[model samples]
Target: MEAEYDVAVVGAGPAGATAALVLARSGFRVALIESTRYERSRPGETLPPPARMLLARLGVWDAFSTLGSLPSHGNRSIWGGPEIAESSFIFHPYGEGWHVDRQRFDAMLASTAADAGAEVLYGMSVVDCSAPDADRWHIGLRGESGEAGTMAARAIVDATGRTARIARRLGATRQLADHLVGAAVHYAGPLREDGFTLVEAASSGWWYSAPVPPDRLVVMFMSDADIHRSLRLTEGDRWEHLLAEAPHTMERVEGCRPIAQPAFFAAVSHRLRRNGARGCWLACGDAAIGVDPLSSSGIVRAIRTGEGAGQAIGNWLLGRTDVAGAYERILDAEFEEYMAERSGYYALETRWPHSTFWNRRRTIDAAMRQQP
Candidate 1:
């Protein structure tokens, strides 16, 4: 016999876990499925001050505070010119931001969802999802050990990150604005007392470095796919050469040593063509709309979208048919605002106007303005 749930959330990252947490707290039978056992290191660890309110709303503020995450006071960056600038969060109503261990942070969210009555299923992948009618869904799951099972649900939530797996499988298309990629590497060292993130812009792209909890530093190079390939940035030696371009960033990690092999990830700005709602399922977080990491709002946006998606799905199940449309509209508006802000940031860097990376951004901005 297949277990049944009011909602099945595929992917237990912050968004999915948050949605599950909200629904479970509302007395819904929810299942939060995750592909891994939470052993892998994920990115997007910077949590801005705004997340404080979101965490409190999710009832995990106390738990998150005890996670040993480091506090970030502000950002120091060299963008748009050769001079360095510092932005402080002192006047912000919420206080300091945080730099957390993504693995632990995500695990904490899932555990909290479980504690709130959502069935947290780890080490499972949703291989197939089908709908028998407009109101019911059947999802096929496979375990890490090859075990198979099925679960029925009244609705589905796609929180599969930038891939939009579930929504794409349901016929939605991904509309990409750029092909940005991040080549990141971590270094282990003694904790540095400085709590501000560092950003340095270069002719090719940009560089950012931030201190993680305990004893590590994360540095990444953000560039277009072609730029990354042309420079062979994935090669350790090439990566180091590029790092030298950002003198300030290089100086900050003078004593640190690489802790692991370098990793390249997709950092493109994109959104689903239909805004990720098809029939009984809706998407949230990066799955519905992924923005550039430069925004520094990835996790915050994920939590907000997750909370919104949970509310929308709950309303739909309770006879509110307009929630999906409303959700789509909200996402569309947010994406537009993000695009404008991203363009404004990119416009600030004009030193390398002829650089392919910068040129592409300018061209994209122009195209966006011409859009009706």
Candidate 2:
């Protein structure tokens, strides 16, 4: 007989773990599956105020806050025209944010799910999933030992980030925008300890810098994928050389060493037409909708979406159909907000370059926009 669970969350990142934690604590049998075992993951160590509020409500903020992470006062932008004025979020009353330790943060989220009675399984990749019935799901997973296993669940949630494995297999077509590509690297020490967002204007694209830990920062240049591809293919070391041009980033990391290899990805804004629910499956996080990386709202959106999915699944399990409709509405609202915010930001940048990366982003259509 195949093992069964009330909820099976795929991809133990922020979204999956949050859903598992919420459901498990509410007395639902939950299985949190992850492909990569967490060991110092890099991306998304910063949490804005909205996300911090969610963490607090979930009862895990204390654990994350005490982990030597710095609070982010606000974000900074250096786009527009000739002169740049730096503004801090402290101008607002609440004044909240965080620069996190991703390794510890992700592990804690997963551990909390397990502590709340969820079965946390690392190194388990979901290879396939299907609807067993109108309200039941069956999923196939490949274990680290090269073994295949199956599990039956009332609902399946996909939090697979950009990969969108389940969405693709389910025949969900996506609309991808090719305006931005990202390349990032982490550095150690002598950098700004207080968290801040730094932006710089460049001919090819724009550069972003953020403090990750006490003395380390993550710096990435985002623009057209062709720009990065050409740099890596033709100029080779040109990417690293360009980092030296960012005023704020270069000053802090004058003599720092990289903790990990520079990673690059073609950033795009896309979303599935339907986030499942034909039977007993749903998708969350990047699997459902993805926006431009420049917004830094992906992690927050993931947690929020997962929470809604968990709630909907809980209601459906109790034979409540109305709850699922509400969940779909929430998804639409959230995605639209994300798209608008990113579109506005890109619009601000477009005034600088006539037909460069900024122009493409500024002229984006309504479909390209998503809410947070």
* TM-score, one value per model: 0.97, 0.90
Report the lDDT tens digits of candidate 2 across residue range 330-349. 77677677767777766665
Question: What TM-score number comes out for model 2?
Answer: 0.90
Angstrom error at residue 157, model 1: 0.4
lDDT of each structure? 0.90, 0.75
Show model 2 residue runs off by greater than 4 Å.
Answer: 233-235, 275-277, 351-355, 366-372
Instruction: Write down the TM-score for model 1.
Output: 0.97
Best candidate (score: lDDT): 1
Pairs clashing in candidate 1? none
Model 1 C-alpha lDDT per residue in residues 230-254, reported as the tens digit of each score = 9886565887888899999988888
The backbone clash count of each candidate, in order, is 0, 11
